[model samples]
Target: MSNFVTLLVEDDALQREVLADVLKDEGFEVLECTTGEAAELIIASTGTELQALITDHNLAGKMSGTELAHFARDRHPHLNIVIMSGTTVKPMPVGTAFLQKPFSPERLLDMVRE
Candidate 1:
């Protein structure tokens, strides 16, 4: 089993659950949140367990996915990030992976693996 841990942040309940299941199926330890604030709190509380972050570009709270990715990158430079969006937004930071919305589970897994 891989030792990688992934933090998944998505506002949509169904989407979050589906992604979580997919990650789990791939043998990753998954932590999920519906908002950036919740994701931030999880990272703050358990920074050591975090190996990567996967977030939706649009969230239900004050902070956007890009903002969360930036924050996580600031706090943990080694953490890998994958940002998913259905709409075009500001360009993502260099080196951060982007997954367009409606992406297949296999594609998402590939992004995380990369």
Candidate 2:
């Protein structure tokens, strides 16, 4: 199996695809989702294979990224979570990372590598 696995949850179709492409370019096995509900289901079923999660704060579904992050952290404590947002909201939990939107692909790659 590949050494890196990443899940990307973003509501914007273009952004999601762009991010997925970047991760793929870096040799990560990437799973993409546009909503928190779908993200939750994917994580539940594939948490063991997931090395990291990249999500946006706002999503198309009822649940937000923060909710998903908390759930994923509870279920998979060792997983790395990175939350992105255009506007600042609440502070993230310790050990979790944040990336502001309008970020360069290089910055995103750096964050994922970290």
Candidate 1 residue-wise lDDT, 1-114, digit = tens: 477889999989999999999999989988888999999888777666788899999999899999988888888887889999998757786568888889899999988888
Best by TM-score: 2
- The residue ranges of model 1 lying beyond 4 angstroms of the native Cα positions read none
Candidate 2 per-residue C-alpha lDDT over 1-114 given as tens digits, one digit per residue, 9 for 90 to 100: 266889999999999998999889888999899999999998888747798999999999899998899988988888989999998858686578899888999999888877
In candidate 1, the residue pairs with backbone N, CA or C atoms under 3 Å apart (3 or more residues apart, or in different chains) clash, namely none
Stretch of 10 with least lDDT, candidate 1: 87-96
Estimate candidate 1's alpha-carbon lDDT, on a 0 to 1 scale. 0.88
Q: What is the C-alpha lDDT of each candidate?
A: 0.88, 0.89
Q: Runs in model 2 with CA error above 4 Å? A: none
